[model samples]
Target: MNFKKKLSDILFLDIETIPQKEHWENLSSKEQELFTQKTLYQRKDEITAEDFYERAGIWAEFGKIICISVGFFTGLDENKMFRVKSFFGDDEHKILSDFKDLLESHFSKNQHVLCAHNGKEFDFPFIARRMIIHQIVLPKKLNLFGKKPWEVPHLDTLELWKFGDYKHYTSLKLLTHVLGVPSPKDDIDGSEVAKVYYQENNIERIVTYCEKDTIAVAQILLKMNNEKLLEDKNIIKV
Candidate 1:
């Protein structure tokens, strides 16, 4: 399928999430019981729910977004550049509120679409759920109620790469490597995000990693469009 949308209208993004608390022991007795019941089927008889808590960041109900990095194209043709910005902090509500403001102020148009590696199944829904949890209003792009599937402005690089084959799953690192795009997982991967956030308390590193993933999503789109990748100098961090 041809990508007819203008690159300038696409907002490429990535998010970093960690479990709501540092450890299972941090949860209240009632909360722990609820989590255990929630994960009973998934964990089966192999491990206790507490033992599985480390993987909770993958679920919106048990996780909190710490960083959201976004990138957009500016200019046209050879003069185009990618500008990246990040909203991150220990306060999940503040991080999400800032992101919501950005969407409302700039990317709320019908033509504007948000892109991420696995956004549809992960990032997109995660953000919407967290926003609801925080009682923040869902941005136009993320509020899909009453809208047709086609009307929702969401683009997933992984979905684009699928080409109708739903059985295979591809990671952004592998996709970038195969497409000759720069790899963004040199220093850290998604699995390490929770540990880095909770154990190391390094929000800056997580922000940097999120920004790189955002840029990689944009690069994947350029590759799919047969456009040249942006040079390092063309990526501006804000």
Candidate 2:
């Protein structure tokens, strides 16, 4: 399949999330009970709700986004570079608001598209949910209430790799490795994100990791189009 969208029209991004609270015990009695009910099926017969609490970051109701790193291609052909910027902090509202501002100010056009590895299932919906929680307006690219499927200005590298196969799932790391792109998981994996955020208190480290994933997504898109990956000097962090 041919890719019609121009590289410059795509904004590649990745997000890092952690459980709403550092520990299960920090939740109130009612909240704890609700969490127990929420995970009853997933935690059945083996683990208690508290034992499975660390996995809460995958759920929008129990999780909060701490970092969102975005990258965009600039220039043409061999002269292109990927410029990355990250919005992150302990304050979820501020982080989301900053990202929202970026979306509103620049990427709100109908021709622009937001792309991620598995954004449709994870990053996109997670951002929208957290935006609602923060009472921020959903940006045009993200607000999909009345838009048809083809009208949605969103792209997923994983979905593009799927072709017509719905049962297979390919991870960004695995795809990058197979496609001869740089691995973004050299420092840390998703499982360690919450620990790094809550225990290590290293927001910068998480931001760096998130930025790496954003770069990887951009590279994946380039590789899919039979284009060269960006050199180290061509990747700028802001």
Candidate 3:
């Protein structure tokens, strides 16, 4: 398979979110009591889904995009290089605004096909909602909501690996492991991101974690294309 044909129009994307926790704490006494009652756990030590939902709203506060990292990979003659650009800022609104700016002016203009692991379910919808909340228009190509499944150019790595078994879902890490991609032992996982964001307020850490995932996604793409992907060592901060 020709690498050029595979990567002719491709952009990989991922996002990190911190659901609304502070706002949930400000609920009135009556509301709080009702929420707690509804979320009571079956086991004394277990936390219920209700408890989590009551404590944290479904959506993060507008503008607090902990991380939104995107990678653009293409072939130049016989070589391929991926440029990963990111958007990170202390202010949630500013972070999201800058992300929207890049999507509209820089990323949105690219003709490349978009790819991600579980992007269709998580990243794409999350970004679309954020764009709508900010009133930022999505790029012409990315508006895949109403299109026929075959008409959409975006690819979800998780979806690709299911192979019609449909009994289980595979995570990016699991796929990378099975495919023999490089695994960094000290990499930050998503579970630790919210704590790192609110407790330490470390935007850089979040960015690094997000970048690692983007690279992992890129590696998955390379594997799918039956092409070799060189490791990128350059660290980007934005």
Candidate 3: RMSD to truth? 4.3
Which residue runs of candidate 3 sit more than 4 Å off their true CA positions?
1-5, 22-24, 27-46, 49-64, 74-78, 106-111, 233-238
Model 2 gets an lDDT of 0.92
User: In what order do the candidates fall by lDDT, top score first?
Assistant: 1, 2, 3
TM-score of each: 0.97, 0.97, 0.78
> Over the stretch 1-238, how does candidate 1's per-residue lDDT look in tens digits?
4789999999999999889988999999998998888888999969999899998898899899999999999999999999999999999999999999999999989899999998999999999999999999899999999999888899999999999899879999999999999999999998999989878989899999999999999999999999889899899998
Model 3, residue 19: distance off in Å is: 1.9
Q: Residue by residue across 118-148, what tens digits does model 2's lDDT show?
A: 9999999999999998889888888999999
In model 2, the runs with Cα more than 4 Å from the true position are: none
67 Cα displacement, candidate 3 (Å): 1.1
Q: After superposition, how far is residue 178 of candidate 1 from its true place, in Å?
A: 0.7
lDDT of 3 at 145: 65
lDDT of each prediction vs. the true structure? 0.93, 0.92, 0.66
Specify the poorest-scoring 10-residue window by lDDT in model 1. 1-10
- The Cα error of candidate 1 at residue 219, in Å, is 0.5
How far in Å is the alpha carbon of 113 misplaced in model 3? 1.9
